[model samples]
Target: MTETKKTTIVLFSGDYDKAMAAYIIANGAAAYDHEVTIFHTFWGLNALRKDEPIAVQKSFLEKLFGKMMPRGANKMGLSRMNFAGMGPQMIKHIMKKHNAMPLPDLIELAKEQGVKLVACQMTVDLLGLKPEEIMDGVDYAGVAAYLGDAAEGNVNLFI
Candidate 1:
């Protein structure tokens, strides 16, 4: 017998750790044949834009400056995770070596695996993002719409 399952992830952080964690979980859930959905808002919106490139800080000054910069969501800037001494470089290297896939690719895979991707309209306006900025295969909707879907699922995670 095939038992269906539902899981929803409401991602609110734009940092690398949060983004990657969400992708990992989404991929795992899809692998298990569970229906998955991702709702992105605030800083999380950064991950949805196809044209929004994530800049790599080249030096200590740049990194420090980035720290002072107002991160769009969660009172934190979209900084990369430091994996001990190796830092973001090591993290990226390991991910590439493992063929773990990029966040955008994971998102696409999730969608291909029947995972729904939703972008919050309010965050769009707040961030001054246009409809064209969103990636292909994404649905733009208000928080209520996401809540409606989330309310029906067995699991909902805020990353």
Candidate 2:
């Protein structure tokens, strides 16, 4: 018998590549008709911003850091590991090779595909960011809300 897979992802990594992985996986899972909810928390909340456009810095130091650090969701271009110093370049190559859809496009796809995105309220309060900062399409909820979803017998993963 094939085991049914239902998942809720508590995404805590704000690194660019990590966010991308979560989004991509959620999209795929949703495509397969599984229920998916992504709970963005802590640093991961950075990826949900509406005003901040994710971009790679041009400075040599920032580029170097980009190689060493995680770029966050808006910037993840292709290394599976954000801190591996190959994230952006690898993402670009993978997108090119696979004709991968862009993040904005992916967001639309996920919406149409029934993927649910939730931003953690605690993170928002801690960051002093308003609810308006997050993209229009996402839902804002507290930890208890996340737990409520996780409690529904879905496979919960902290990614």
Candidate 3:
């Protein structure tokens, strides 16, 4: 019997370009019949957030976090040369010109390709992100869950 190859990525950055890189790699691995898992923690969770606010009950602190953080991948900024948030826009325009997929489309493609998307349960609590605030088809897990996959994976990356 053959063992399934695995690829585990720890997505710890919120930058638009960084998140795009993570998803691009994840999707590529999945295409090669690897079991791909992306564990999103810290600011990386912003990449999995929904574009619009979901009607969910929240405490004062949770509400504050909701209001302060970027709503989704579309709102994520670049890691450098952001120039007051114009960097991502410029990059997006360039990507379109080259006929490359946008970050949001890449994310959806990863999901459609059966890549497992995990949100850090601990960070979710720390950031006060409600369940409804997250995108659908994501699993909520702790570090142990990520470690389980990483331990047996042939490829492990931190993005």
| lDDT of all predictions | 0.70, 0.69, 0.93
Candidate 1 versus the native: TM-score?
0.74
**Model 3 Cα lDDT, one tens digit per residue, 60-110:** 988888888889999999999898999999999999999999989999999
Please give the RMSD to the true structure for each candidate, in Å: 7.1, 6.7, 1.3
Best by TM-score: 3
The model with the greatest lDDT is: 3
Q: For model 1, how does the per-residue alpha-carbon lDDT over 57-131 read when each residue is reduced to its tens digit?
A: 246654454444333322323354454434545666687899877665776778788778888888766666666
**Candidate 3 global TM-score:** 0.95
What are the per-residue Cα lDDT tens digits for candidate 2 across 45-142?
76676645345324665345334432334554333464455656666678879998756576677778878888888776665555645677789899
Off by over 4 Å in 3: none
- Worst 10 contiguous positions by lDDT, candidate 1: 69-78
Clashing pairs in 3: none
